[model samples]
Target: MAIEYLGLSQINGPLVVLEGVQNAAFDEIVEMTVNGNEHRLGRVIEIYNNKAIIQVYEGTEGMALRNTHTRLTGHPMEIGVSESMLGRTFNGIGIPIDGLGDIDADKMLDVNGKPLNPVTREYPRNYIRTGLSAIDGLTTLIRGQKLPIFSGNGLPHDQLAAQIVQQASLGDDTDEKFAIVFAAMGVKYDVADFFRRTFEESGVSDHVAMFINLANDPVVERLITPKVALTLAEYLAFERGMHILVILTDMTSFAEAMREVSSSKGEIPSRKGFPGYLYSELATIYERAGIVKGSKGSVTQIPILTMPNDDITHPIPDLTGYITEGQIVLDRLLQGQSVYPPINVLPSLSRLMKDGIGKGFTREDHQDVANQLFSCYAKVGDARALASVIGEDELSPIDKKYLEFGQAFEHQFVGQDLQENRTILETLNIGWKLLGMLPRKELDRIDTKILDQYYQPADRD
Candidate 1:
């Protein structure tokens, strides 16, 4: 039996408030009947005493106070998932929109299911290659690790996300089926279409599942998009035993949606007008990724969020850095130079990079080479700053060499074709070749034996 209410006390934005409600649980699904026959869906978000606040998923556009009927389903909202979800497209709420019929569901899962126990989580050790030298050679992404990309508006984060979906693979080529669950929150139509075409053109659509919430869709739906995408990823990873990659693009939109709902509900605001519980709310989504103990499959997350005004300390990126393992930062300065990925190595870091590379994983010199590059690049920055004050001709010989090394590093190493996929060996060799531009003493960060083996100087004509 269900509890039905004749009229709502208030309809504010996407929320409908009903008074004197009894036994109504939070997150319980509600069916609202409007104009005698039309149906709208919502979920109870908050309850105080006898008043229940429901967030309408389909928008409360035509909702009427006197005639509408609110019936509680007595359960939290769930998504029907099945193995057939691969190669399909769904709306933000998980309804099939590819003109495909409903999935013959294997099970139904609460979108807000509990996260994996900390005790059952295995340390993420293996590397996931995105094929871009900027990420692979420098800020490496580790399997089962949550690494977020911090980009700004008008940047190419979407292109980078799409490229990763097209190119990311396991260290071992024979690993199990690698699948992508991509969720686009409040993006434009062209942006969503671009991802679809890129997947199809790369022949990787068969390995991808997409959930889209466009800019004009109900704002409340944006809040559900990533959760729905992650739910599908959990099904594919743990149940079907497949390696899964979940990419949520523009999480800023998701956060904005939360802010909007909070404001509508008259909740107090915290930093930059976002709700106070924003950090924990984001964790509910980002923390869902990882390898469970004894499971053959793992879930890796690459959450891409645009920093407002390119501000890294903004609430969205600031809180994200605390929760995620590391961040891949995109620079507008490099974008102005026409860089494809525009990943600024100075601020970008992967804390788990050391764990994922070296010995049998990538290469023995991987860590040292990475260290030397950062050291040299830091010097290059100093040399450029000095040259700006005094002309390049007035600089010391070593300083000039650092200048030359900087350009070579960016053009030859950081700047790579968007479609080009380099093997780990090829990427490392390119790093060594760039390092050879400078004299042997500049390679102090690298071990002596390893440098002797890989760092021979390029013959200057």
Candidate 2:
């Protein structure tokens, strides 16, 4: 047996230091017999010499150190993995939270699974059609990629996450097969209910699994939520060969939870009083998403977090930007204009987009069209800034046309109903229509041959 019962010598916040044999590994499970009758579970977090520091899973309360006996369970906490996990709701520890009974499965897998090998890593090139033009056209989402969404307070990030879960698809029924693993941390009851209703109404509950750690739950539980979510995702994707999309909403809350736990452990704080290991902690989660070689499945990630005070420079977003492939930025200004997604097309980008859109993937003209649209919109932004100070009347006619393009770009491209899912061709067509408002002489960024083929007649109704 890899366990030994020992009396606790000291209690430090949620951490209980025990004098025992040095046999427990990090994150190993331990059971503490408290007050002779009450039993509590804890995890071995740190080991110094022969002393072990364990974080109580149920919180350390009403326990006397002299009376409590600690026993180490050789293995770490684990959850069952199988097809039955689909459409079910689980807590942070992978226990059923949907009022369903305990899951009975043949095997239990450890929550902290091994990462994919670099030599066996497969390239992620397929597109995940979210039906949002700003994402599809501007920052295309590739299957098995880790793309985070950066939003601000009151920016409808939750709505965007739900829309993706509701509308996300790989391809038609014959070719595409996919599922969603949604994990919400530090959200309110109403928000969780909204997601439940959205999934039920959309008839996707069978293909989507949810693991929620609400705001009122213990802060330490939030630290385990994403790991639990990814564990199931890996099981479904790598083992079952199913394309899985893992959506984690409000990662900032997760970081805050980490900060709280670190504070409880008396660790040094980083920026904004967060833990110093915040970046590495986030990487452990983000790096779990990808395509494994010799497997037909892939795990794509879309982690959403609100920037505190709309500050992208904040540690959470700043660190996230470095770890993930790219980010989709939501604009409060566009939200004020009543745009549904409020995606700021300029700042948003997908680094893996080049591999996902081309002749074999999307279309031959996809790259050129996207570039031209970006260039024209950038010019429009410059024109609008000038017009704000110099007045539209003082600007040249060419600059005035750009100002009009900017207005049409946001209204026609960025703005769309959350329910609408436009095809790739339709999204490209919309871009062409918006560009048609400009004079033909100003179309320098696009090739004349492609322009002749795609450019709609400005006078066409």
Candidate 3:
């Protein structure tokens, strides 16, 4: 039997500290009762000597320090899982909120999942097409890779995330068994409603499992939302043999929750007053995505975070960039131009793009075309900056042409309908058309054979 500690020494924020604790384990679930029978759930976060600090999930608003009772459950927080989870809507802590009954659980799994063995982990390969040219043709998302989308305050990352959920796939029908675990933290009611409607209206709701933590909810719950979502995703992927894509939005909120908890616990602060262990703490979640050697399925993660003040150096985005595979950076300047899914291809990259493109994957010319397009777009930026200094009329003929190509690239490539779903072939062909605007002499990135095969000047095409 586990020990029960009565009369906590202190209640601070969402934390409750208990004294004279014996045999208490870290992360053990604790049941707290006050006023005779009022109950709440908490977990042991810190324990040393005879003192234990517990983080109450439901907050400690009205509980007095000397009246609360804590019972250690001798188990870490676990979420019940079953095949019926698909199409269901659950709150941050895995409780169904869609008026549906409890999941007919096949098993109960700990949210703190077991890490994949490094020796048995597989290198991420094969493409996961998001059907967006900016992503598919340039920064391709590979299965088992943890790529993130870095957006700003007003950018349309939510719309972009919704579009990806509706259109993402594992190429052809050979691996169509795909599922999505969409987790949102600290989102407004309207924003949450928008996602729900987008998924339902697109008819992909049945294939998506949603975990939402609203802004009004207790800040402590924000910390548990992503873990619950990833837990469900692991069950769907490794156990049920389905490809699972876990999308976590606004990780800034989750990080803020961590800071709050750390401050409440009187822990030492690091950069920007955030907890010093922020990097390792985030790794515990992001590193959970991958393919194990013997497993037939894979887990790909797309964690979205808004850069505070559009500053990439901010702790949230900076730490994320270090942990994830790559990032899709959304440009606020492009968003101002009324572009939907305004993905700035130059700054965005997918580190595992090489393994997922060429030959049997996307196309033989995908690599070259993407490289050439980047080169041309880079020149366009230079030309535009020069034009601003010395009038466009004074610019060289080639520079003028680059300006034209840049406009065309943004219009036809970077900007697309929210509902647009372009196959890799279509995306590659469109790239060829855009590349045709540039002179053949500048197409140095492409092989001579590829240039000879696909390069057509605007007049010739």
C-alpha lDDT (0 to 100) for residue 177 of candidate 1: 76
Candidate no. 1 TM-score: 0.97
**How many backbone clashes can be found in candidate 1?**
0
- Tell how far residue 111 is off in model 2, in angstroms: 1.4
lDDT by residue (tens digit), candidate 1, 235-301: 8888888889999988999999999999999999999999999999999999998999878888899
Name the runs in model 1 displaced over 4 angstroms.
none
Reference-based TM-score of each model: 0.97, 0.95, 0.97
lDDT of 3 by residue, 1-461 (tens): 66777788887899888999888899998999987689988999999899998998878878997778889888999999987899989888889999988899999999989867799999998889899999999999999999999999988899999999999988874745889999999999999999999999999999899999999888898998899899999999999888899999989989999999999989999998899999998898899899888888899999999998999999988999999998999998889888778888888999999998999888899999999999999999999999999999999988988999999899898888878999999999999998888889988899999999999998772
Write the residue-wise lDDT of candidate 2 on 145-166 in tens digits: 9999999988899999999999
Candidate 1's C-alpha lDDT?
Answer: 0.91
Give residue 225's lDDT in candidate 3 (0 to 100): 89
Cα RMSD, each candidate: 1.3, 2.0, 1.4
Ranked by lDDT, the better of candidates 1 and 2 is 1
TM-score of 3: 0.97
What is the C-alpha local distance difference test score of candidate 3? Answer: 0.91
Model 1: ten consecutive residues of lowest lDDT: 170-179
